[model samples]
Target chain A: MIALDYSQFLTFEPQHHWRIGIAIYLFLGGLGASMGFIAALYKHIFKKDDPSMFAWSTLLGVLLVNFGGIFLILDMFVWESFLHGHITEIFKVLLAFFGAAVFNGNFHPWIQWGANFIALFSLFGTLWALSQADKAAILNKLGFLVKIANLLKPLQSVWGWGTIIFGLAVAAYTGFLLSVAPAIPAWSHPLLPVLFVISALSTATAWYMLWTYFAKGKDEETQKVREHVGHQVEWADIALIGLEILAIGAYFNYLYYAYAGGKYVFHQMLSDMGFVIGFLLVGLLIPWILEFIAAKKHIRILVPLAAILVLFGGFLLRYYILHYGIYTYPWPS
Target chain B: MQEQQNKQLPNWVFVIDLNTCVGCNACMAACAQENQTPYWNEKWRTKVEQAEVGKGDNIGRIFFPRLCMHCQNTPCYYACPTGATYKTPEGVVMVNQDLCIGCEACVTACPYDARYRYDYEDVEHNKQLFGEEFSIHQLPHIDKCTFCYHRITKGLEPACVSTCPTDCRMWGDLNDPNDPVAEIVRSGRAKPLAVHLGTDPKVFYVGLDTLPAPAKEEAE
Candidate 1:
């Protein structure tokens, strides 16, 4: 019998709404948020007043998030306002993104929620960075910045706590944004948020470790402290990378073995050789093994390569999930 | 609450007969002209999809006219960040281009792939092709099939429906008991695509299956 079948295999066009641009934003945003949160946790756990690590993490978070925001602006087509000589176009976009998410009773449309979280994370992260500037003596040459940092020093804890809350929200929200999109089979999963959080933590940890390895501190004691930090973060990345591997494996099994929706997503993933070779093997498993060996043998030389691979793997993971995010086609009756 | 409001207004539905669709492309032309859609760029508000069937001597084609499902449970509506994609009381899913930020979330969320970007560039291309004969869209935003909303509300059939030479497309109000198109839907003579998706689409298809489905009574 002749049938007008709406076959899933006949997907002629993949979803191009989100591309590499979005992948970069999600990556940077997740990285920034995780760095900010992890730094706060480190301070609380270590009970240290030394501000270099805290200041650096928060400062990097503010910068990365703002940089990611530029990609969003590039993606938006608000040329109507621009053509009309309205520079407040971005303000309108921001207000709409933030206001709707904040005021809406149902709290719908995950993008707005994501934007709100990112904004809060950036704001508190900046303030936290400023507060630490005076103590860290990194921004001591900028007298007014130091003065402002000192004046706001009383609210330092508030900024730190806000950074943790909002930063974590931003990280998790990036995954949540894709989770709610049911049409895209690859992204619409409960496991996505878990996977993203793990990636965020690991990538951020690897980044800070790299910072310690590279950044030159003047004092002998500061150099020792940074070395200690680099060692500590290497340990954290080992655990975090392990978590990421498990999360990704679970994600694979969930989609590759579940119902048609799950199968549909993995079908696309499996077809793309890059998903396994680029993302799984080179991006994830290789790095995981390297980091494991490095930590076990106390091979400090191997940490940087593993760290860089982890960061690359994190981006590749998101890249595959998004780029291969084929939409579920309708079935003909 | 939307369903409650739909009680007073028309719950518009389309019952499209695939068997009768000759693939004339009249509906496409009419739709493009009526809506000023980006037809030049092959971005259609409504277009017939073709699939070949049978081997050799008995070769035939299925002409499936595709458009926005205007689902009762709209994924596009749920996905809109600024509520730019909204459903009218009369069951028409519409996009408020003014509120649209061109984020393309709704485009990705649509299972039907019905939505497309009708940006300033597309408008500029329209000018190059059609000149100033068309009044440009005020703001660049996502565009999709609106079911000829302007005509339907004024006690007129949708442009495509009215222009269909084969009478393949039928429009009616589901709220009215005597509505013929609604009766076609009620009788199980027609059914919507992707029933499993739970989109609850208002548009229904007829005569696409040559073998006929399990008569909607196999379970019973």
Candidate 2:
């Protein structure tokens, strides 16, 4: 309903020196990266057996999802210029699949390690870029690293910065991203980032567990590997949930502050009116409940569902933050 | 006019006198009118109404006309990914539309929600509003108040300062001790918005008694 207020509105200046197109472009890039992971994960966990399916599927999903949004946002006639978007999209798909196969077995350990390193770098680089966006000097410095592997050394440096660094980079950026526009009072809280990081950690752990469960085979060594992976997954999930509780508590504290200041509009929306019900129902409670059920019965099916729900809820959390914040703070035209 | 023009024009500043000012929203309205700002539905600039110190049975209001504070060390300038927003040598906080990626980094970095996205028009209004081939980049990126830089560059006071019927606003320079701004600071009559924000706001307030408490101010 609220989306109607800002659906396809253009905020660009006709004769201005610059364009708003870049935002659309960057959004697409980010979307590609995120959707890539989603596609890869879904294909790997759900639709296994294409041999090269995992890589191709994930890369294609990421590019298409991200590019699709871009085209729609820009009102580009995709039918007219299908090749423009499709060429790069298809190339990346094939490349991703080929790379995955080449790096599949232990025989290509160095290449596998390199690929993993690149993936890790991309992950942490995104987190760092989000964090660095807060500071001019740091962001400028980080902006210089254009390649994936080049980002790894800096990412390694970030590892020593501890959970707080990762937490601040990933979490605070989430809040900053949501809150900066001011139109979304519901998304304006400082605590949203913390919640985001907790959600991320939870999703990551759940995915790891899902992967291990599916990868298990009828052998002692394989079982041992699966067991270890399972332990890591469970521990990560517990830690993520614990951190989420802390973030939720902080959000309440922020609300109290806002309420006392007579800016209770967002507080009322998030807490009293059941707007955040989905967060509690799907994001928080559902995965928690499913996880508990799985723990008691060892039902492997429930594990994937729990992981999927938790991840879906994480995305929903971001969506709500964006939309609700916009709802609360319309452009004071 | 020639002499007035030749004499180095005192760099204009905005001094908000908190003591006599009532939070009536008059200045804010006048500001929007003078600037032809979009609308409240699209606020380019805004007045932050703060709850001032209250007496036993009486509550007071402080009207802080908040625009881009145009700080010397603007955080938004630094956080911008595309180098879209930056400060000029004359200390105006401005955004370069072409360079802006619209990632909204500068928008987010600012504690003040001063930055906003200007995106593609909705499908229904697309052709009616903008004609065909409506590019998103054709829209504005992050839009904010620029202290009427166009007018200032042409040796005119900002619209908001000129339009304040109550004379609640004053413009001068921080560098010139003879300026009202310098005098006020020297006399310790000047204050700021959220001093603890480490933002080091250049927009100073005089007679700031009507502003809300810091705790309340921070939340807004």
Candidate 3:
């Protein structure tokens, strides 16, 4: 049987739709993990009297994101019954069980530990995929691994310096993935990864706030913990707003340069991308504004909605970057 | 002094004049034969593409002869696991048949979709005809255009260049100012594939009228 060009199946073309799908995938992955991290961290930091909601919510978010990988089957061209070798076997089957634990809301220690391990592994898997494309020229498979290492050898120290920073920042890694692809004007900023890290934190904080606010039938100490944690989340939202502004401004600056050079980049950005209107304005900008207002007024109700919008917008941002970076303009005259 | 040092090192380059190429698949045929590559398999180290842009009767089509660009900083090299891919001292981006574990890392690393790994039967057929020891179960390695490194090492022009019924293909040291290939590039008539990617490709197209857009959407 002829091997189907797997590349075609992966992208599922016409450009725009591919972008949206990738955005959704990244969004699910990032949002889930971020939500989990913030919930756990806040409970740990604040030393809340309540049993940690961090463990449960974090698990929920992570499992939901890993569940998104089910869509990968829709793309496999061969659809052959052939067993995957160890190279492709990096995506372990155990991830499913860990994901299940999150949704089940188990407070068991073993479950939380297993879920955390899987979440961390899945994050590395995503990073490994991105690192797969770091080379400058991609011809011939000669001493390929060695050649790749030669290229990366110099960057090893740099990678080492930033590993913990990257870990703490969480989904900020997704931003670095886009930044490496210089082709996309919107995603090619030095600050893109930094912005992603902040968003990850924001998503984490928001999940914690929601979990805490909803917590009831608890002791007085637990109730006090819930309200205190909610206040901390409110502050995080403020920081997210600042980061979002910087990311947007830098991206637009890149667009200006790309447009001014008569690269026809602006046309693609406006016409092709639904993010500017759908994600940026409605999802991110408006929600951010409302959250700012709500923060000042100490209005907790609007904060969740704002968090929902911010998270939605973040996914859209990732979608456009991944998709648009891959899309090419028709060649010059 | 730098120019003299540059002359001592082999700066690999392929220059294709779009005007003379007839899209006859002569270079493709020659490359496969010389490399002992399997036909009807996805193992063409060099392939000919008929590329055109613009609309209507005014459209101009050019024969695009493509191989690995042998970039100064190659992306595919790093993606490999068994260390099968690397550049030779002769500056050709090449594969070591002995070392290649055929992991398909370079295949994904390539944005151009140039690399293809053939199965054991195909590899055996190619190796058998050359009177070399070969196997069927485990295929040798990923195959691509070596710029005919074997012939070039023996001080011969590539089979593709020599077999071209039309003298459209040019191969030489691109680093040298005195070389015709360098002169052509300095004259601004030659263009590299995906210059925006910053691969600094050695293969340059002369008389290219249009950019060949990737028919397949995926980058690799």
The candidate maximizing lDDT is 1
TM-score of each: 0.90, 0.57, 0.62
State iRMS for model 1.
5.8
Docking class of 3: incorrect
Question: How many steric overlaps does candidate 2 have?
Answer: 42
Give Cα distance to truth, residue A293, candidate 3, Å.
5.8
The candidates, ranked best first by lDDT, are: 1, 3, 2
How well is each residue in A212-278 modelled by candidate 3, as lDDT tens digits?
6566524676667677777777777767767777776776666667533223444565666486787
lDDT of 1 by residue, A61-127 (tens): 8788778766765677644456655567657765665566677653677788887788788888888
| Candidate 1: residue B6 Cα off by (Å) | 4.9
Q: Report the error of model 3 at residue A189, Å.
A: 4.6
Measured with C-alpha atoms, the lDDT of residue B86 in candidate 3 is: 72
Which 10-residue window of candidate 3 chain B scores lowest in summed lDDT? B211-220
Q: How many backbone clashes does candidate 1 have?
A: 0
lDDT of 2 by residue, A176-256 (tens): 444432223345466665566566556656656565666653466546645655655665576677678678667767656
Kindly indicate the candidate among 2 and 3 with the higher TM-score: 3
Q: Residue by residue across B121-189, what tens digits does model 3's lDDT show?
A: 565566676555543213445677777777888878999989988878887776677888678877888
lDDT score of model 1?
Answer: 0.79
